[model samples]
Target: MKKTILLTLLVVSSFQNINSQEKREKDLLTSRKWYIKYMKFGENKREISDKTKNENWMLFNQNGKAEITTQGIKSIEDWNFGKKHEIINISEDGKFTEYKIEKLNESELVISRKYLNKTTTLGLKK
Candidate 1:
């Protein structure tokens, strides 16, 4: 009976460790910001509008304040993992454009916007 209890405890401990590790990895990956690589309209390729590549950074304070930044735009985003795990926000530069979180996976995010005459996408760096 003692041996069985020990085995069960060991198995439970192992599962706990795995669960914690998985959660940590998920949190780390989810906190990262993803940018757009290319934008296309039907069959045409749009010019890359983001001039400063290194300026892009996704900020997550873990307190519900998340922002994604690039050259001339800084967006305050809302992330909801239960329903949609992506950065959704608007430009802070007064461009009056709406932004959407296009794709967010383990290591990347794709952000996009539609303005008066153009649609832009930015590829995020990890």
Candidate 2:
């Protein structure tokens, strides 16, 4: 009986840890501003220069909304993550865009978007 209790406690603790980690990721993403740092368009990969680094940013909110600043212009829109947290959908000006999340962490996010026959990779940093 003691062994069974110990095993159950271990399993419960493991699940709690996983839940906490997922919550942490979501919290981090919504609390900070993310800037575009790199992008790959077609076969060309380019790094953002200091001169243009402040041109684009994304601010996600816990209320299922996001504000995007591009070229000093701001737009508010609705955004959501997939149930598995591997996809991001953004709707703006009646246009919906979906991006596959490649990586996400405290300071960086990478996403891949496909439109038409082109696939573009975007790297963002906080």
Q: What is the lDDT, from 0 to 100, of the residue 44 in candidate 2?
A: 83
lDDT of 2 by residue, 4-29 (tens): 99999999999898778667767977
Off by over 4 Å in 1: 1-30, 33-53, 67-87, 91-97
| Candidate 1 lDDT, 17-124, residue by residue in tens | 876754554476456554434556534665444565545566654554567665547778654332223434443554333456675566666666675566666555
lDDT (CA) per prediction: 0.57, 0.84
Which pairs clash inside model 2?
A: none
Return the lDDT, model 1, position 50: 56
**Runs of candidate 2 exceeding 4 Å displacement:** 1-22
In terms of lDDT, the best-performing candidate is 2
Among all windows of 10 consecutive residues in model 1, the one with the lowest summed lDDT is 79-88
Candidate 2 lowest-lDDT run of ten: 79-88
How high is each candidate's TM-score?
0.43, 0.77
